[model samples]
Target chain A: MNYLLDAFAWIADPAHQAGPNGIWARLGEHLGYSVVGVLLACLVAVPAGLWVGHTGRGRGLAVGLASAARALPTLGLVTLLGLLLGIGLVGPMIAFVALALPSILAGTYAGVEAADRVAVDGARAAGMTEWQVLTRVELPLGMPLLIGGIRSAFLQVVATATLAAYVGAGGLGRFLFLGLRTQDYPQMLAASLLVVGLALVADIAFGLLQRFATPAGLRTTR
Target chain B: MRWIGDNLDVIGGHLVSHLLLAVPPIVASFLLALPVGWLAGRVRWLRAPLLSAAGLLYAIPSLPLFVVLPLVIGTGVRDATNIIVALTLYGLALMVPATADALRSVDPRVVDAADALGYGGVRRFLTVELPVAGPTLLAGLRVVAVSTISLVTVGAVLGVPSLGMLFTDGFQRNIMPSILAGIVLTIALALVVDALLVALGRLVLPWTRPAAAAVVAPTQAEVAP
Candidate 1:
């Protein structure tokens, strides 16, 4: 109870809210890395996943790889990468990208696979090129799921970004680290609250994006 | 034969410590998560916010949390203290989504049917909604347990005595065998925790098997075909 009060006090303090201590700057830097990581995952995973889903031959391999990716403990992966990259955001960044890929890949696969079969046949009957059929029909239908994958990857990257702080990548985790070292409960609470708050705000925004992407029928059903 | 005698104590100690570190946090997180999740489900506006909150909580980096926690509660692991708090935060991710989705996914028709049958709101939720939602909720618990097992390694990195400590100790001392031992033991611990959760699911919620295992497990037909 007392600890909670102290935490609130620290968050409320005018001094702590200033300049570098501004919540957005700390969270913004963290989000920047997360965006980069997810963008990189999407760049590769989306196209590869799209092709795999379109043909259905390489899907087994794709799914296998995604599961293998999940099987890896993120910390273990990061530590292993750390050995090669040297302790910094780079190692953690690679691990985060790896973490984001499986979801994006899977989501993209499902999205494209779920495209209406008739539409594709109709496009073929109309003499559309394979690429045209995909671009005009498959990718459009796949957008919601693809966006879902992006959202999932983004949330994951955001959460995992905290881990980067371990190897000296700066973020809200610094306050968390400091609180632990100094036994400053208020500071720790404040930092944790901030991180959680940041994540919640991001998720709500993502949910809105999902709703927007959702087809009208589904939105009403939901 | 020589290796057995030389490392028996170290191996045994780590085994006990690892279980001690991992189990309580998972159990505590479940206890904290259930009611909160149920409450969030009852209120329509609350669901997204609650889930988002949980997701964010789950995203927290464990190492920083470990370092920051000592300042908040004045350190040292008590059954009611620092470790449980950390574990609770970690579990929040799995718990919130699992619980919320379970509740949300309860077929809307079922809830409507209960209302038509003259069941009160609370009764409808408890008798009708909760049962159908059982499998999904359990699935969430299972995810939390596995993730918690992995995240517990953060404790060792922070100088907490556990299997993670063994890993850290072995790493620092450059003792290859011990590091290998820690990795093996931690994997064993995670696997065991996961297996136990699966067993619990089968026992408590039989229908949950389809929802949980189907995604992660290969169908027999897929394999045999």
Candidate 2:
């Protein structure tokens, strides 16, 4: 009970909430890496996912990639890349992109799969170009799941970005590492609470975004 | 290569410990999740709250979970049981959802038919629902096994010996080989375990061999040439 109070005290401490090493600053760095990582992953995974979903080719590859990505240890990957690329945000960012890609890709293609097949067939028969079929028919129908993919990707990257501290970048993980070294259970607890709180906020926010983004007609159909 | 050869004994020990640390959590979490997942699958109202609660477990970073869980569970920070408990929670996060989906994917009529045949609650689930849920459950197991194996390394920071120690050592000491070995070994372990699960699935779930395996099994009479 005392430890819990101390953790909250540490978080609420105005002294601890300012300057470069402050809680807000660390949170910024963590969110920055996470947001950038998911966006970068979207660039590569989204296009490939759309092509695979529309063409129905390489479906197996996408599924395999996502599962394989899920199995990798985030810590090992961050350190491995840190050694290879030299320690900084760049290395962790790359790892996050790799980690987030497969989930997003799978979500993207699965969304397209979830769309009404008859509508897709009609779009094709109506002489729409391949791109038109994808954009007009698939994109709108598949947007929800695609966003869902982004949500998962965002969640994953945010959590894994904590390892960014290990690689000598700034994030909430610094507090975790710092707390452990100093035996400051309060600091460690505070950091953990922050990370979890960040995740919950992100998850709920994404849940709302996913809800609102869905075409209202399709919402009832599901 | 020489670095790897020189460190083989150390690496081998970590590998064994890694396996030891990983397998139990995967097994325990699967067992623990079955009832909860089954309940969620059967009861419509419970599904969201149960799954969302399970997912909250995943949001807790392994690093912090490793450090702080000892507080709640009454164990030393470095205890293997500590990591085991933490990893099991992680496994439950993934497994419950997977298990629920696995059960939900089965044909409702098969369950009804089992009830119609005088099978009681436990018997119906064990004989009828369990077999049909096998392929998807096994699929979930594969992911759980792979991820759990890799996650075992995170315990190294707290001084639990495993392949993750190599990562910690390599990072602090600038020993490139050690880090490489950890990454390679973790990935290799994950892949090998995943393949074993797939093979185990094939051996145990023969009904799943056919294209219509989901609807096959005891209801084989319904499948036509």
Provide the overall lDDT of each model, using Cα atoms, as 2-decimal numbers. Answer: 0.71, 0.87
Q: Which portions of model 2 miss their true places by more than 4 Å?
A: B210-225
Best by lDDT: 2
Superposition-based RMSD of candidate 2 using all C-alpha atoms, in angstroms = 3.2
Provide the clashing-pair count of each candidate structure: 7, 0
lDDT of 2 by residue, B5-91 (tens): 998999999999999999999999999989989888879999889988887777666777877787788777678998898899999
Best by DockQ: 2
Q: Give DockQ for candidates 1 onward, in order.
A: 0.18, 0.59
Model 2 pairs in collision: none
Candidate 1 has which clashing residue pairs, if any?
A159-B59, A180-B67, A180-B68, A183-B71, A184-B71, A185-B71, A185-B72
